[model samples]
Every structure is written in C-alpha cells, then in structure tokens.
Target chain A: MSLLQTIFEETFKISYEEANQDLAMQDVANWDSLTHMDLISAIEDKLAIRLSSDEIADMTSFDAIKRIVNEHQ
Target chain B: MHNIIVFGTGKISESCSYYLTKKYNIFAYVCDNDFVTDEPFLGKPVIAIDSVAKSYPPNEYAAFVAVGYQELNTLRESKVEQLTTLGYQLVSYYPQHTPINGPIGHNSMIMDDAVIQPCVTVGNNVLVWGGAMVGHHSVLQDHCWISGGCAIGGGATIGERTFVGINATLGNAITVGRDAIIGSGAICNKCIAEGSVLITAETPTYRLNSHQFIRFSSEFNSRN
Candidate 1:
C-alpha cells in the first residue's frame, strides 16, 4: 500500500482502493477540516516530519501531499 | 498610578487602552516606525516602538501588547518575546465582570463577559474574547486566542499559540495541540494533534422556494 493510501485509511477510515491520487479534500465524502488535520497528523507521525502551516494549507490533494512528503524525505 | 505603554494601534489596542486607562496611566501607543502617525491616539502620542525605551525607561513604564491573532497567533507570540527581551514588564488586562479563580500569566487579556472558572490555567499573551467560557481546570497555553462565544470544556488543554474561532466548542478532557486552529461552530470530542486545523462541515442548502409556500398558506387562509 502507498503512503497516501495508508494515511487516508488511518485518518479518514476509508478503504485503500478509495484512497487514490484523484481523491482530494473537496471530492472525498469524509475529508472535512477535522479529518484533514487528522490526516496531517498521521502523515507527520508516519514520515517523522513536521509540516509548516503553509504546507498544511497547500495539501489539497493526495498527489500534492505525496510530492511534498517525497521532497521532505 | 503605574505608567504603561500600549503597543499597536489596532482595534485590540484601542480596547486595551480603554480598559487600561481606568487603572493605569497610559503614556503612549507604540508601534513600528512605518505605522507611526501624526495624530495622537486617545490624546496620547503614538510613537515608534524602537524609540519608546529611550523616552520611558522600562523600569518606570510597563508595556502591554495589544495585537490580535495574526499568523495563527505566531505574531502575537513573537511580539511578547520581543517586548520581554526589551526589559519591559508585560501587563495583563481583565475586565471587572470576568472571574479568574486561578493565576493567569502576564500580558493576557480577558475581555468583558468572559468567564474563567476555578482552577483554570491561562498562559502569557493569551486573549480570551468577550462572552467566552473557560471551564473548570482547563489549561490554555501561552499565546492562544479564544474567540467570542467559545466554550472550552472542563479539564481540556489548549496548546501554545492555538486559535479557537468564535462559537467553537470542545468536549471535556480533550487536548488540542500547538498551532491548532478550531474554526467557528466546530465541536470537537476527541484529541487534536499539533498544527491541526479543524472546521465544521458546511450546511447544505435546499432548492425549494419559500415564497411559493407562503402564497399557498395565504390562499388557504382566505378560503377558510
């Protein structure tokens, strides 16, 4: 499973198949502000990295977040 | 009376000036050199922050930072640190109606109609806006901003530099971490991690017209 898929599953309680790059905060049913924060937290924990406020705000899609995580790592 | 200097000339600074005038002697309003205007604020001179220490020695005149939440409260936090480093004693403002049962940190502001229940710990540079409620035993860390009508439940812990929007609520024993932002009308029952931003779901709008229903009701009333 991909890192984004794991984050979506753990933070939003969604299936791995549903956690695709196309899935975004606006498109996903469960990706409200609360879940968005949870996802950020989960990503930070799994990756062992902290994200700035601007970075958190820019994470609108799974693809964008994955790229950011890759860059940080 | 103790001589005090108010930093900033914004709305929060104006409110702080109004509150501080009753107890202390407000010497002047201090801000950046670019923000300095010719006109006086509340009949006191608005001077540059860099020049304030030279005129009014830090030992003689204390300072109060009246800036509101900007940059998710990081700005206010930085201002507090800067003023402290300049050797100025930071002053706190609490309205007469607000009841603080426990010790609150310096440079904090508790506006009118806000209630701080027993055993609550409020840290430095915190801002509790009007009509907010801090439940018993709750801990609000340094540089946090609790907006109007927020209800923080008992024993809840709000981490440093967090921003709680107006009318937001937190369940008892919940913990919100540093740099968090809880949007207006949001209700949180679980613990929130650091740098989290939580907001309520938008309300769905209906397509039905209310004017048609009103017309039908009037016709039925006339027939009866």
Candidate 2:
C-alpha cells in the first residue's frame, strides 16, 4: 500500500480501499472533531514529521493528503 | 428539602461529595452496593447507595449516583431510570465552575477547570476531568472520561467508557467508540472502534531536555 493509503487505513481503522475523498473529513458522520486530532497525531507520529497548520487545514482530500506526504519527503 | 446520596468510594466521588457538601443538603454517601457510613459528609451521614432508598424512603429525598466508569454509569443510569419510574427524582449537578451551556445529565461530574461549550450533551456518571474542554454540540455518552487537558471539538460523539488521554485533541464531528483508549497527546481525526488504542508520536530523545539536576545552592535559594 502507498504511504497515504497506509496512514489513512491505520489512523482511521478502515480498509485502504475504503478511504477516499468522497468519504471526506466531515462527510463521515462518525468522524468528529476529536478524531480529527487523533488522525493528525497518528499521521504525524507515523511519518516522523510535523505538519504546518495551513497544510493540516488544506489536507481535506485524499489527493491533498497525498501531496502533503510527498512534500514531507 | 433535597436529600442527596453519593455512591462509590473513588477519589472522584469523594471530591464530588466534598464539593457539593457546601452547596447541597447532603444526607448520606453510599459506597458501592452494601457499604454505608454514618460519618457526617458536610454534616450529613455517608451511606451506601443500596440502603438509601430503604433508609431514607424514596418519596422524601433525591439521590446522586457518584460512581465512575461506564459500567457504573450504566448501572446508575438504570437505577435512576428505575427510581424515576418509582416516582423519585434524580438530582442533576452542573458546577458553576464548569462552563456547561447544554444538556448535562444527572450524576455527571464536571470537575474544576472544565469548559463545556454550547449544545454539549454529557450523560450520567461522566467525568469531565480538570482542564478538559468539551466543544460545541458534543455528545459524550454515559461514563466517558474526558481526561485532564483533553480538548474535544464541536459535535463530537464519545461512546461509553471512552477514555480520552491527557492533552488529546479530537477534531469536530468525530465519533469514538466505547472503551476506546486515546493515548496522551494524540491528535485524532478519525473514528475509533470500541477498543481501539490510538497513540501519538513522542518528541525525539535528543531534543528533549533530559537534565534532571540543575546546580543550586542554599545561598541561591535564600537570595532574590
């Protein structure tokens, strides 16, 4: 699995195939604000990198998330 | 006119009993199912929860379930339902110190430094620990533990017994399942399962200040 896919799957506890942009951050009813913090922490932990607040805000889509990961490296 | 009874022997319950002592007319403290004590808690007898109904007579007084965790919350919820069914009113407490702007259930403990925002629905026996913030429209189910320094965003739903670790942050509109363990400093953006444990990254050891002993003298201590 790709890095983005792995991060999403592990952080969200969903299958890699299940994580898509359409299942957007507020689109999922169960994905509350607290869980968003958890997701950020999880991603940050896994990647060993810090995310800028602007970058964190901009990462609302799968493609955006992919770009963020790419930029980290 | 209101008779209060506290359940459980935990520190939280003790603190609740102590805090409420001055504000309410506490009659007894019922620890668990069978333990009862006559020691005056704020000048009232500390009795066990089970014996309160029998000793005090349900018609005359009300009770507060002071137990912790989801199991006890569930039990107290059922008991409250039963008591209400039997025509006894369950007392609801919202400490003025905690900023509660929404529907907080009976038997919940809103400790010192808790900031409960608008539209939050906190269920019974919930522990909003010190320095915890419940954002707008959040729904924390019965027995949830919003640990000290934890920040929950708006419209979040925390399942029963979900223990949010210290300084853990959750985004808005998230749902964490029952018994979920969010590790300290974790930033959550996704829904967690009933037993899932989500941990955050620790700062590298090299960057952390590991120095334990700083050079100090008695003269330095005495000086300005």
TM-score of predicted chain A against the true chain A, for each candidate = 0.87, 0.74
Could you tell me the C-alpha RMSD of candidate 1 in Å?
15.0
| Top lDDT hit | 1
Interface C-alpha root-mean-square deviation of candidate 1? 20.6
Model 2 root-mean-square deviation = 15.4
Q: Score the docking of each candidate (DockQ).
A: 0.01, 0.01
TM-score list, all predictions? 0.69, 0.59
Pairs with backbone N, CA or C atoms under 3 Å apart (clashes), candidate 1: none
Q: Could you give candidate 2's per-residue lDDT for residues B1-224 as a string of tens digits?
A: 46666555566567677656656677766555555555555455666555567887778777666655455245655655655664556676666655454657766777756888877888865778768888988898876777889999999999986888899999899999887888889999887778788897886542112221111111123333
lDDT of each: 0.82, 0.68
The model with the greatest TM-score is 1
